[model samples]
Target: MRRKQAGIALITAVITAALVAALAAWIAWRQQLWFFQLENQLDQGQARAIAYSGVQLARFTLRDDARNNQVDHLGEPWNVPIPAIPVEQGKVGGRLLEQQGRFNLNNLISNGVASDNDIAACRRLFELAGVPPQRVDALVDWLDADGETRPGGAEDAAYLALPQPYRAANQPLTDLASLVRVQGFDAETIARLTPFVSVLPPQTPINVNFAPPEVIAAIVPELALAEAQAVVSRRAGRHFASVGEFIAALPERVRGQLRPEALTVQSRYFISEVDAQFGRVTVRYAALLERNGPDFPRLLWMRRR
Candidate 1:
């Protein structure tokens, strides 16, 4: 009877030890999972904060530039790219681009009236970019207030007739990607046009001081690509101070064809592209900024990807 009791006690002890070991292993696994989740959440929040900080930095840079300089040019300090700067366990980088350097697509319409000159300029831009100019009419009709379809353009009636159809916006484009809704524009054409065109407030003029060679060529049809490139190169060393100075620098033949009012030395719109990386995660932000005067730059919009 003593031996039997001893054996039974030994068996009970072994079973209890096994149960304790299993329970401890389970608790450790749960703790590790919770820690991992907490770390991931912290990383995401940190990345987002870093991106917003980058945008604010850009805003300050633009405000400072506006206060100090009268002319916005490619050579300005705001145009300089920001190298990646390490923060507490992460890094952030960004660059500012003058939005007025590209032709504003909304310029095609003014006060409910379609401007022939603006349309022609858009056509020239499309031609220069090797995109088919056939879509120009569609864009005009899409933006114009009237429902009447222009030749080769689509209206509500035309779009509704398609297999998977929707109505035309018939208003100013809020975003550049909205161009895909207009007839004759596809993702490929938009990709080609994206670098040189912007969707800004209607009637915004293109800033000649920072305009790229392609945009300059589009604006002044008489100027050859090489000539526009030369102008850009010259301006890099000595920025154009005024529309008159820009016109004076142009060749005599091209001078007469250029429109003075369509050019500007200053810009109100800019884009700040920022990238923030934390651990294995990366966040991209595009902040649109508008500076009207010496005041701090206003955040127009922010897009994250």
Candidate 2:
């Protein structure tokens, strides 16, 4: 009887040991999953908040930087500066750009008309940047109010000669990407030119306080690259106090394109970013608050990374 009792006790002990081990393993697994879930939730919430805050910061920075988005914290203006990259899984950061600092799209045909000087300037700018003048000349022909192609430009005749079908953009460019559609305008070259030019209203010239080095060189033909760099460097963390003050920083030719009214201390666009880490996500927004008004920031672009 005593031997039988001993056997029963040993079996019971083995079952209890197995059950305890299984319970411990299950608890560890649950803890690990909970930890990860909590971390993911925190990151998501933070990213959403940071992206929202970025929009506000951009609006504020634009206003503080004379509506020039390139201004860094040091008060130095940038022409086509790269944005800050994201770090720390859940952190968010972004760079702001000002459209007015670039060559105005409307500059293509000023005041609903094209002028010889403007055409020459545009052609010269493309040439200096290594673009074929023939291509730019054709682009201008398409931009003109009439359908006639200018001399040295591509027209329907030229288009027909090409194997690939092509169409002229007879109307104004509604977006900045239209440049690649022009003949001889490749994506590589356009990407390089993006820093210097803009597709904004043609009547507006670049704001001196915000003009990138490329715009400075394009606007003021006489300006050496160093001279343009100097203008950006010497501002001592400040924007040009007036259009005249800004002109003084330019070469004689750049002065002609600028006007007193061209200076603006307001912001028209902004980029807000948010980063989250169930993976990563980034959202960008453009803010339009030309006047003092109350409105929640609106969404512009959303990207997940």
Candidate 3:
């Protein structure tokens, strides 16, 4: 009976030992998971701080450029892309683009009236981009204060007839992406037009110094694509000093078609982008800035991803 009790004790000891070993493993696993989460949180916090630093750097660069340079152009230091700079366990990079370089979609409407000149310019842009001209009227109708639809435009009545009915905005576009909601505009068209257009404050003129060759060609009806491209190429060697100088460079036929008031060498709107990387994680920040004269630049909008 003493021997039997001794065997039972041995079995109990073995079982207890197994349970203890299992508990230790579980505790170790839980601790490891906690450490991983902590590391991730730390990396994310660092990345966010770095991204904001990049934004401040962009703001400073823009302010300095505005102070020293009378004109904003592609050749300026501000236009140069910032290469990734290594930091503690990570890196950051960014670029600044002048938003006024592109055509402003809101230019279609002025106050309460639809400007014929602006509509013509937009139609020309769409034509140059190979987007269907049929959608142009709908865009005009969407922004015009009145409900009266243009010949090819869609009003509230037309939208209501659709399977997924919605109302016409009948107001200025707050965002460029809002184009998708306009009649006859699809994802494909929006994608095609996005690179050449922006939704800036109403009445902003196009900055000829930074506009792409295609946009230049669209803006000047008489200017051929080749001629626009030539102007862009030449600007690299000698940037246009003023709108007058740019007009002088154009062919007489093209020069005659351009309205001096519709062009400018300066830009008020800009986009700043920062990409921050930490370990295996990455964060991005994009901010839109509006610089009015010598005053400090204002952040109009910001987005993070």
Candidate 4:
């Protein structure tokens, strides 16, 4: 009878221990779940706030940087006018680069005659950069009004060999990316040269006051380093005060090529990019912007998010 009683007590004790272990495990599981939920909520909240704050910070940083120095939308500095704007997305931030500050590649072959100094520079630049003479010549032919191909430009004969059916090819370069299609240029080459070039509406001249050193070399390869340096020295404390002022700034040899009517301050496109990471997450964005600005900066266009 005593043995039977001890056996019942052992059974009861075993059952009680099982129930206690199960209960403790349930509580620990719930705690772990709640801890994860809290962490996730905090991370999302912080990410959203960081993305928006990035915009404000970009504006502040850009203005201060521009004021401190004179570089335009490109990385190079100048003595001419430049503006700043705020940009950000998903924890990343950057500034919109104003494309108007540089010479337009579209001007390379305007009309039957390449009458612009910008045209000369573009040719000279492409040549010095080791762009095949044939490709540079092809660009000139593509720029001309007539169907006749220049010495190196693509013609009807060349186009017929390709997959597309086309006639005379005289379209302006739509973007810096378009240059990659030019013969002798590959992804690597485009990456190297895109910074020194811009694609604006037809007939846009190179802004002499803000043209970079490479651009200066491209414009007039004959331009000795001293002459380009002199151009920079003269630009300080003055802006092409007017179109006429800009014309007067050029050297006598290159002076005749400046077409006053073709120059303007307005720009039709810009480029901006953003990259960000918050904790385990990362995001990147690239876009094109188109807005003219004397004061306020705003978005005119954007690419996919």
What would the TM-scores of all predictions be? 0.85, 0.59, 0.85, 0.55
Candidate 3 vs candidate 4: the lDDT winner is 3
Residue 167 deviation, candidate 2, in Å? 2.1
Instruction: Report the lDDT of model 3 for residue 33.
Output: 96
lDDT of 3 by residue, 96-169 (tens): 98888798988889997998888888887888888976778888888887647533344677888889987788
**Where does candidate 3 stray beyond 4 Å?**
1-31, 149-154, 157-165
1-305: candidate 2 lDDT, tens digit per residue: 99999999999999999999999999999999998888767766666666656556655544555533433323544223335455455445555555666666556776557766556656656666777766666667667666365433347556656788665656666445677776667798787677667664356545666666666666665667778788888665677665566678776766666435645433343333323222444444333233122343344444442
The window of 10 residues in a row where model 2 has the poorest summed lDDT is 285-294
Best model per lDDT: 1
Distance (Å) between predicted and true CA of 282, model 2?
A: 5.6
Model 3 TM-score on a 0 to 1 scale: 0.85
Expressed as tens digits, the lDDT of each residue in 157-233 for candidate 1 is 77888899777777899878789888888999999998999998888888988788888988886788889898888
Tens digit per residue, CA lDDT, model 4, 1-305 = 99999999999999999999999999999999998878766665555555444434434444444455443422333222223223232345445555655557777756556655655666666665565435666666555665366333346556556586444456677667666565456798776667667776666655555665556556554665566667666766665545566556667787665455655433445555544445544444445544333333344333324
Off by over 4 Å in 2: 1-53, 60-91, 149-154, 159-166, 221-226, 236-238, 250-305
The TM-score of predicted model 2 comes to 0.59
Model 4 alpha-carbon drift over 4 Å, by segment: 1-90, 109-118, 130-133, 141-170, 217-225, 236-257, 262-268, 277-279, 293-301
Candidate 2 lDDT for residue 120 = 62
Q: lDDT (CA) for every model shown?
A: 0.87, 0.59, 0.85, 0.56
Task: Give the residue spans of candidate 1 off by over 4 A.
Answer: 1-35, 149-154
